[model samples]
Target chain A: MYIADRSGEVIYHPDQQLIYAGLTEESPVADASLSDGIHKEVIDGIPQLVLVKTVGYTGWKLVGVIPVKNLAADIDELQWFGVALLLFTVFLLAFVNTHLSEHISRPLSRLNLAVKAMEAGKENVEFQEEGCEEVQHLAHSIQSMVSTLRHLMDDIIEQEENKRRLEMEVLQSQINPHFLYNTLDSVIWLTENGRYEDATRMVNALGKLFRISLSRGKTVIPLKDELEHVRHYGTIQAIRYKERFEIRITAEPDTEGLYTLKLIVQPILENAIYHGMAAMDEDGEITVHAWRKGGDLYIDVQDNGLGIPGEMLDHLLDESQPLKHSKGSGIGVRNIHRRIQLFFGPEYGLEFFSEPDEGTLVRIHLPALNEEQAAAYQKEGTGYETKA
Target chain B: MKRKHKNLIQLGILAILSLLVILSLFIRDISWPEKAERRVEISVIVRESDSSIWSEARQGMAKAAADYGVELRFLALGESNSVSEQTELIRQEIKNGADGLVVVPAQTEALEVIVKDNPKIPVVTMESSLEGACISVMPDNVWVGEQLAAAIEEDFSEGHVLLVDAAPGSSGIRARLEAAEESLTEKGFTVLRCGADFTVETIEGVDAVIFPEPESAVHALQLLDQNGKTSSLYVAGTEERILAGLEYGVIRGVVAWSGYGVGYQAVEQAASAVLGKELSEPVVESVLVRKEEMYEIENQKILFPIGH
Candidate 1:
């Protein structure tokens, strides 16, 4: 405690050295005329809480000076303790929050990721039945639904595949008799013309073509064998037409290893010779070209014969429409289209482009599958499938 | 949801309790007591003010007073070495009901009568001895002087040494110088005495300059620097001067004591006499300091009297 006179002279202080020293010049309390209350002031850059009371009848102020920090010592300690407790509590809550979120969302997030993987064509995904009852039930439901859907889809695909294979066999058998009859008729005519060597060659080509057609009961064969079959068919047709038309078959060396449906090119060749080149007066030309472009093999048959009218050409590949002058079982171009669509999906099929008297070009599009791919396509009904 | 709400309520209650505890702590006042019980008042009188040495001594006295629960009042005789002013301050403290006295007498003989008359009050003299004082707390000056001479002798067996005498009036300083001179002379060395302002020309032929006081050592260092001389210097003084001289290579070694320890011991001795307790010892210990061994623990205690 310190006492200062009315004129601001320091009269008494517990620190005796500060007394008799000029207090009026240094202390803010000396200049303050506070009546009787606590006042905060700065003295020599230190904050002080000064309690000022006027001495009765003396007009001297009795001041009690305490540093502001000293007054808040207890409070400062308590504040530090509170802050430490708060930090510890927040850290604990963070740990609990992490554990809680992991317990609640971990299984759900795993299930979501499994569903996404399924959408990306990953099969037979297994989801864990953990977490809450609702989440476990949802996982169980999804697992059952996926299993059922997979079984149903497999059954439908197998039945459809069997039906398409049966139809292909039937169509393939229908072409055999007509092809043999035409070839034998040519062989007979060659012998009648006294050309015994040509007749022997025609008979040998017919024998080779039939051997490749019945290739161990396999529906798909290498393009090399398919082209050879077409060559034999053209030789017999050339003999029958008697030099009125020419048949030229060419294939790229790279396409020799690739596979195609059996009797595919033979039926198309028959259509071109009978329907396209039969009524031609001058010598007509039939060119068969096979090559590989990207992931597809294209075989185009161009015949410089009397081109079919646009109306008939448009309805040629439509099975629902009957041909005006079709000679076969009325399923010629449409059967090829259906067989290709059933084997390789609708994206790989037949496309025809023609102009009147300018000849017709038939493009047969098929996937360039190797030996292993063709075997997988036949067994598991799976291949390098492309979208339409 | 019910469990979560209950947890939030518990958290809220805990928060409120914490806030209340903090608020209660904030409102509580922390201040010195208005009055202490049966406290004895002791007055300390020193000859000079505004000196770092005296300020450190006052710190020791204040610590003792706090430890012993005694009310202490420190009185200074302005800044001069005035025996009359110090004597008058002691008389004033006695009149003001001082229960005991700790004085560093300006002149030991001049304050004898006043100390003799104050028979009821216990008195302790510091840095100097009085004939009738209850006790005297001071450094062993004779031993310090011998140590200083031995330190210098380590480098020089025989040389003409110049001793710069700064405190000619203090008997304690005089006795230390006499002992140093006697020890150095007995070692087959020549000793010469000079004032603080001794020029480089006066010290040209001297192999070493010995200063028993800090001021004189500082003065000799300045002279050596100004003259660009390479003479070896030694001091028996405070740590500030000795450490600085050693660091700058101006002085080779020091013979010193802990000033703070001396002051602390003085107040302790005074309080012991006041409480009718037997005194342990009157003299404080000194240390021999060298540049190489200055950082050793025992020597460092003397060099840094205070922990800092």
Candidate 2:
């Protein structure tokens, strides 16, 4: 039943029929949604307490009645509280996750960066060590392992490099003694022939070569220094196989700053003089050309003498085999090949090509010397690189 | 009536006997609470130039000596502020056959080499002591500055301040200046800095000059007096600073630490270490005194006798 208190008349009922009972004509209950006193009656009927609030409408009073039992069920208290708690929990979790990730990611990224650097052969970057225990421990372990591996690999490389260097030094020493003996023979011949200037030049070139060779016990030389060595070797070859071969040297201005591993270019030229052109009837020409292309420095020594077969070209750079085919001049070329590869790495090395009855060309590629290297070159001069 | 009189006489006799027993017990306990008969000679080295702190420090040494019933040989080094003089005095103390030495180092860096070489002697240092001493007893300077900074921070939204580091390597002064600078700067303030080995010549272009100890205030006043500039200066330091400020009427505000409190703490620490007694708290304590809260530091004793 529904009623309007102002009109004193019924407004609504479960039975929606216009039925007027005993009520005043001017009663406001006539237009009420429910009978005015029905809420009070219902509260009286139930044992539980009912809360009723009078809500004002535009032209009527809305009596909102709520039973104590239905209040919780209808309002859905747990659902709303659960939603709020869930939202707060989600926010808290998000905050923790962000904080944790930020902490973990920094050290992890540093470790990753360190590992990448090590892989890229940079053994000098220090990684930050912090964060959660597992990550910290992992970082520490990785760092430790990297350190151990780095030290061990460094030792191995150093040992191999040292062995290669010792062998190269021994080879150089052997060459020095032989050249000394040869120079003494040349001096004797010059004294007998009375050509004092040529003898003196020979003796001086030998002294200069050995002085640069033994160079305060170092192995590295500037391109200019190496070219000077080349000139000396050419002098020696000119003295040894006179009128058999003529060597020409050309250098780019910018390529002068490039550094070569000590005694690298000379050995190749020696091989060209002794093996390639010694038997040629006419004067054979050996041209040593150096130029910079992009970031790389290339040195090519080409000789117009006996060309190489395609089959022997593969094993020509191999260090183990002695050069047995053409009076064994491959020893010097192999040494040059190994040195170029060892210094600049496998990606850069000596490239050989020959056309039958035309000529044999030896090409050597090296890293472009940087400012620090130039500074080191100036400081160390020509001494320590061969030793190191 | 006759029985009552007899009972009263017996009660009087019992009361007299109880009083005698109580007196005997009290006298016996008084006679022997602990042994106070160990006589020892100690050297007190003061690195001051006839300043009031030096005088108060001597007074403290005298009190300690009298309480312990020991002879105190006092060595006054330098013209008060010279670290070189203090260094020279330490060498003299070592040479004088003093049993134990107490030195207040004048400079932090100077003591590094001096203290490193000397060993096998019990060296007790006090008052803003840092570097090269085995045992150091000084009030927390950073806390003092922090308290002052926090107080200033409460009133203003932001503050622009200048710090005058009176002594550079004096740990007490350095720590205070650092704390104040850090706190004020942390709260977003522009801080200008200056360093002086002696007195602050001028603070006109500054908001505040934080003097870590009272002696520095005296030096500052002396510097100002020489120029005939009696400008009111806002300063902070020890209880001696509070007293100096009150006497000079130049300081706009005074922040002080309890000298007696530091002394009491040192004594308690020494006693605990001597008698193998456990400490209830950390051996060091610090407090602050501001102008608005001058009552807290007014009547407090600067140095108290250990026994008294």
lDDT tens string, model 2, A310-366?
778878877666666543223456566655555546678799988877889988888
Across B133-247, the per-residue lDDT of candidate 2 in tens digits comes to 5556665667777876765566455756666665565666677778988998999876667655544444544555556566666666777667766544445544454465655
Q: Candidate 2, which segments miss by more than 4 Å at Cα?
A: A1-167, A170-175, A318-331, A375-388, B1-308
Every candidate's DockQ is 0.01, 0.00
Best DockQ among the predictions, by candidate number: 1
Instruction: Give the worst 10-residue stretch by lDDT in candidate 1 chain A.
Output: A16-25
Candidate 1 local lDDT, A1-388, one digit each (tens): 7787777655565433312111113463464466689988888789988898889888787888888999887897677677656755764675566567767887898999899999999977888888989999999999999997888778567747754665556456546677668777878877888989889989988888778877776777888898899898788778777767888999987787898977788778888888888887657899999999988999999898777789988887787786566664344676677777767877888999888888989999999989987776666543233221
Please state the error at residue B193 of candidate 2 in Å.
Answer: 99
The DockQ-based CAPRI class assigned to model 1 is incorrect
CA lDDT of each prediction against the hidden true structure: 0.74, 0.61
Q: Candidate 2, residue B119: CA error in Å?
A: 98
Interface RMSD for every prediction, one decimal? Answer: 14.1, 45.2
